[model samples]
Target: MTRHTVNASILLTDRPLLERPAAARAAGFDAVEFWWPWPQTATPSADQVDAFVAAIEDAGVQLTGLNFFAGDMPAGERGIVNNPARQDEFRANVDLVVEIGERLGCKHFNALYGLHADGIDEEAEAEAARANLSYAAKAVDAIGGTVLLEPVSGAEAYPLKKAADALAVIDSVGAGNIRLLADFYHLAVNGDDVAAVIAEHAQDFGHIQIADAPGRGAPGTGDLPLDTWIKAAQDGGYDGPIGLEYIAGEGDPFAWVQA
Candidate 1:
């Protein structure tokens, strides 16, 4: 009896942003998650925020997770955490994301570690990331929320490419509220043993997102043993909703998981 959440940003792209929540609900999902809805603007207008909130509420879906304003995701920028020039923007986004999460009762926020900035040294970038992550962790602590650090693939510039990579950052930050977002598809693409990761680090997971390797498609569309991996995660104590953060094939995306 595991629950599932839709990554509306990727799953329901055929519809308008505000409409995706209802579309997901219509598709039989009770919960949804998103990369920041406004990609270009870190802090959007109040009206924009209200509208986003209303969409989820009107659709009667719980917002299970959200990513803190990662810069221009479509343009190859992973995040701004490691950028000194954009620190203010990242901090602004943190407050806004937390506010939205509090209104919707969402508890998980993914903070994508940005690509290395040209002028900054590796140690400098790492220090900046630690500071920003600590700030995000503290902001969410008041709401009993968790900050997530995920390992991503497909973007070579994105430094974190394995479970251990993200976990190391979590350890350095030393924040109890910060944890790992073990995205199985990304891990598999990066060549990590998904089964071993599940068995070894499920307890450190704050949330889990999934897609299939070779192609970020629906579970059955590729070769990853998602079902087996998920069961191992469950056995190791990860009881949160499984995030279907995949690209749909020709037909319904949820068809593979439907009862």
Candidate 2:
């Protein structure tokens, strides 16, 4: 059977992360992903982590990936890449992600490209993103995992929004372990041809996240061509989990996209 996973971030906001395994399983998801696991907000403590791991195992649910290191604390606007001042913080974040992956046996990690500073040269930003990706790739490589560099929408300062721009940064990084993570809502937000773009970057795509275009809700809740894009993804040789990273609509988001 083909496997598709939903992120716990979408379905279990009312409960803590440690309690998400049961929720995901109850929702008929065989595997799940999450945004971040740090500082004990959404993440569990060490003992809780162990318990959560056991719960998932007992429930027969897998963790597909983790979106790591969203932004600098407090402000939470800018990303680790393209911000020279946050390189150390970025490295530390990468370490934490790797450690979590090791404990959880996850194979994929996603990095959010935060906003850039004003007056920053585009080329310089690309170079900085490439360098940061390279560092993350190495860290992921050491753990036998791959890193997906995601270009988010709704952020004007993000250097990479278009598929071509993200591909360029991935090429510059030149790390075999680093790949592109395409988010459907973000692609639509940035006005990219979603199906065509995914087809074009098929080989470089490591994972996919999906939601409705306008409100980032469940598939079919908005105007994104989810069926078309999903077909295109299959044609492009993407065999990993299709992540449901959207806001829950009136009911189960998975119901809208069931094949």
Candidate 3:
């Protein structure tokens, strides 16, 4: 069976933010991931960062993947790495994110390139994104970390609508530690051949996150050919933990199958 890292941001919504790590451990997850836990601010207070790290440590589950602060998540902010106006905010959060990584022993970082509001020059934003990604790469290199690029589906007209699209951005940055984050749910939603994608780029991926399509629900509750894709990923040389970034609804989400 393939072991999975639970995405605490989505799976443990029932509990308070600080308690979700323990909740995930109780749910039988030995590893977990998270979006930027702070939604309101790109740069959180030192106390906030320390408490978050403490919670994860207390829970005893390894943090496998974490997102860099983009903007207000619930309010539809995807990422600000490409936004020139928010470049300072992104910069301020970069080292803080790396600091947290040092504390957690986690080396996988997800960087979302949110859509800059309309009328902005696409070229400028893309350039800003390239520069920012490179900047992040330099900081994380201290810890031998990899920065991730994820393409969300129909998310606010975001430019990275596909895995290949994100790969292009990663390449443009020319950072050795940058890699693609193959999210099955987003790929499936956008009509990408999930298996073929895995077959072709599995080796280039630093992380894999999944959920069922149609509703972003737990696996087996939707029509995604998860087994085939997982097998393809394995056959294609991806030996990393696939993260479960789905909604559990009202039951034990980890009950999908034993890892």
Candidate 4:
């Protein structure tokens, strides 16, 4: 049988990170992922990190992945993968996240490419992303964890809109510890064929997340052919958890899946 996990960011909507594990368990999620859990304004403090770890143990919910720092959250930066000025900070953040993952018994973390800079040479940007990813991959390997590089749609930090592009970056990094994170919503928005891409990137994909495209809501709430996509992933030999990373609509987000 296929297994699934919920992104705590979706279920715990307004709750603090420390409280999300229990909430996820109450909501019947066996495993959980989160956006980021660093020293940002939105994250819990050091003490809260300890408490969060305890909560996960008590709730018996596995911490599947934690997004690396989203880069100065108060300023609305998404991440640090492509930032030249913050390369060191980005590396440090990855180290910290790996530590957190180790402490929490998680093995995966997200590496979101930050916003693209206008007028920057495309080749230069790719090189920068590759270098940073290499560093992150080494760190992940050192800590016995894996990192997934997720591509965003709107801005072009790393234009990995297509599976080929994502795979190419992974190849450039040349590290087994770094892989692609296939998000159906982003793939659809970027006009990539989700199922075909999943099949093509089978060996290179580290994790999967899903949401309805138009509204970014629960799987069945929008036009995404989730069942077909899920089947394709299964056929592709993907046995990892498919994270429900979407927003809630009117009622219980899991209602449709439950039925």
Best by TM-score: 1
Predictions in order: lDDT: 0.92, 0.76, 0.89, 0.77
- Please write out the lDDT profile of model 4 over residues 70-171, one tens digit for every residue: 676556676767767677777777776777788878888888877767787767777777888888778777768888988767555445666667777778
Return the lDDT, model 3, position 139.
Answer: 88
- Which lDDT value does model 3 have at 84? 85
Q: What's model 3's lDDT at 6?
A: 88
How accurate locally is residue 60 in candidate 2, as Cα lDDT from 0 to 100?
Answer: 78
> What is candidate 1's TM-score against the reference?
0.98
Question: How large an RMSD does model 1 have?
Answer: 0.9
* Candidate 1 colliding pairs: none
lDDT of 1 by residue, 1-84 (tens): 889999999988888999999999998889999999999999999999999999999999999999999999898899989887
How would you encode candidate 3's per-residue C-alpha lDDT over 178-257 as one tens digit per residue?
A: 99999999989988877778878989988988899789998888999988888888888888899989888776677777
lDDT of 2: 0.76
Q: For residues 101-162, write the lDDT of model 2, one tens digit per residue.
A: 88778989887776777787766766667778889899889879998877678767676788
Candidate 2 stretches with Cα past 4 Å from truth are 39-59, 72-78, 119-125, 257-259
What is the TM-score of each predicted model, taking all chains together? 0.98, 0.87, 0.97, 0.90
Which 10-residue window of candidate 2 scores lowest in summed lDDT? 36-45
Weakest 10 consecutive residues of candidate 3 by summed lDDT:
250-259
Best by lDDT: 1
